[model samples]
Target: MCPVQLDGIGPLARFSRRSFLRYSAAASVVASVPILTEAHLARAQRNTLPKNIPPGAVRIDANENPLGPCSGACSTISGLIPEGGRYDFDLTEKLEKTFCEMEGFKPGYVMAYAGSSEPLHYTVLAFTSKDRPYVTADPGYEAGMYAAKVNGAKVLMVPLTKDYAHDVKAMVAADPNAGVFYICNPNNPTGTITKYEDIEYAVANKPKGSVVLIDEAYIHFSDASPSFDLVKADKDVIILRTFSKLYGMAGVRCGLAIGRPDLLAKLQLYGMNPLPIMAVAAATTSLQVQELVPQRKKINADIRQETFEWLAASNYKFTPSQTNCFMLDTGRSGKEVLAAMQKKNVYIGRVWPSWPTYVRITVGSHTDMEKFRAAYTDVMNSSTAGLEPMPLPRRLRETPFTHLS
Candidate 1:
């Protein structure tokens, strides 16, 4: 990875001397031999929610694929039934190899989780302390910040660039105790990508012991490739991955993280769980179809572009995106739009207090986007839209925002 140089102008100049030192420390640890341990997870009883509940309402809320596992993955999952109670390290091993190849990294650099959120939480639990801090883009992903906050770590919130991509220099400058520097590529709500080099600099110039965690959950739909080279080069950086998106396997629970052996070892404080036979079977099958992503990327992109185009023609403002989703600037109360859509049987994504005029919209199938368009039109054009608006509870609201934009 091309490490970011800390001595710079514009944003970096804002980092206090203490903050610069903190960023340096973060970079050192990530670049060093293993020092951090993965924290342990207190296992909870298995979630028994039904797997295939139909979306009765036209739902474009979650960034989930409306259509589920591809035929190859579906068949493999069904085949795993016979060994439902068994543990197959062989299957897991193969899956790891597949993951390594796909990311252009090695097996040792890769680790598995039930979902990307698991590792996201563990990274916080393992690293943050009263003296250390958690730094991330405001109005980005929420799960990581909560983990850090509950762990008693200070949280440093950085604003995004005017264009919506992460302000990498600000993130790097907010160093010192910055335990983990987070960049959610094609960010969660906005779906914008910071240039690969900017992220590289943040990782390279961050505090020596600090870790840079890139949440690439939307990478499949995003045009940018993740920085696995940093892992291959043995730099202290973690790239998170998930099958939850493209594979439609959120219910099955599978995620991966890649970094140098030492950086990954930090997460080892949390012991590994025996592979779920079904998850392994399906994930392996999903990884086998290397071409499946490119094929679907185009289809998803076409749908996303069509929706954005319509929005543009209608004078709706949205964060220009390079992934399967984007944030729509409703030019009014997003909560108002949300309630209106809900009443019309269309529920889009979450709201951000930071951008009260914006609401996130996942790129669903063509028909679902059409449903959202109609509902949105009705809501915006109706008189009831003037009613008082309600927001998501604290947790949901906080996760999707850093500060008012």
Candidate 2:
């Protein structure tokens, strides 16, 4: 596979004075509406778990990094506990500055949030509307779809190509007035990548006034190139980065939105809460560790490859994933397998409606995968006679974005 280049994208010049003035005017009304975030989405995903989880359960759900924050990040966060009382907004600015300098982007083009989900929601709220539909791949990350629901925008779920890559051309032609085209590179659920040229094609051919939202949450785990070059060229693109996956900071909650200043300003209209101090400190220190990304990438890749090999030897079908997760096809109903695995204390990922027979599996530590394999094999051979799949979440219908327990 051709690797996506990762070299620094050259610095982008600041937006015009007029654009900054306009953004300043719009920033006044901090988002009064409560928006759905990734935490809420995670809760929705967790609805699949049993009422009571026993101790020592092998949990490979949620695609979380088993290796927690690096030593430097832990120390930096620990050292900042005393000053937690004060809202060190300057630390956020410094964090933003550190990331901007590293990525060759102007400081004004980036904004730090608790996690990328905030900006993801804000982007849909800012760009999409009832008439201007939201376009995304079916079985892609569902966070944006929920955000679109909040905005009362119609969602167009284009099916991924036969190869499991985003059908960029179909997405472009899905709706002529699409407000936002969301792409999750190394897509969630299915860890397959849509090519860089296809992304460029979407940028070039997408409807006018529509922005292409690229979620690179799992980019570090994949060999694909980052989309910073589009932002550097002043395109209508916003790229989201997070410390959750590879950096092992999901609970710490630090992420960023990279785009043109004018584009980022639209997100500011949603909200501007100060970031968590510990998250900022940890993220800053993590960025400074130059060797952190490659080292962790190898760890995840090796484990994932080992698991894939086992699945092949056992004649189990799965996507050729390049990241921390992949979709596995259970010969029977995926929900039955999920429930049976849960009984064995080996909880896996949820099932997507588009592919009822396929369940997403997060690549965990080698030991975790070994247990998963044991549980999975036993479940496959045993009869699922009385097993019942977890009930579909009805709370979403009751109230969109309501936290599901």
User: Could you give me the TM-score of model 1 versus the true structure?
Assistant: 0.83
Total backbone clashes of model 2? 2
Model 1 scores what on Cα lDDT?
Answer: 0.72
Model 2: CA > 4 A from native = 1-53, 397-405
- In the range 40-105, model 2's lDDT, one tens digit per residue, is 543454434554446898867788898989999999999999999989988998898998898898
Work out the TM-score per prediction: 0.83, 0.88
The C-alpha RMSD of each candidate to the native structure, in angstroms, is 10.4, 7.2
lDDT of 1 by residue, 1-405 (tens): 111233443332576686467555544433332221111100010011231223577757667787688889889888889888778877777777877776577557787767787678667766777688888887777667766766667777788998888888888788576778888997887888888898888988898888889998888887776777776777778889888887788668788877876666556444356668778778878888878888888888899899989999999889888776789987787767766776676767666656778878888888888888888888778754554444333533343223422
In model 1, the Cα lDDT at residue 154 comes to 75
Backbone clash tally (model 1): 38
What TM-score should be assigned to candidate 2? 0.88
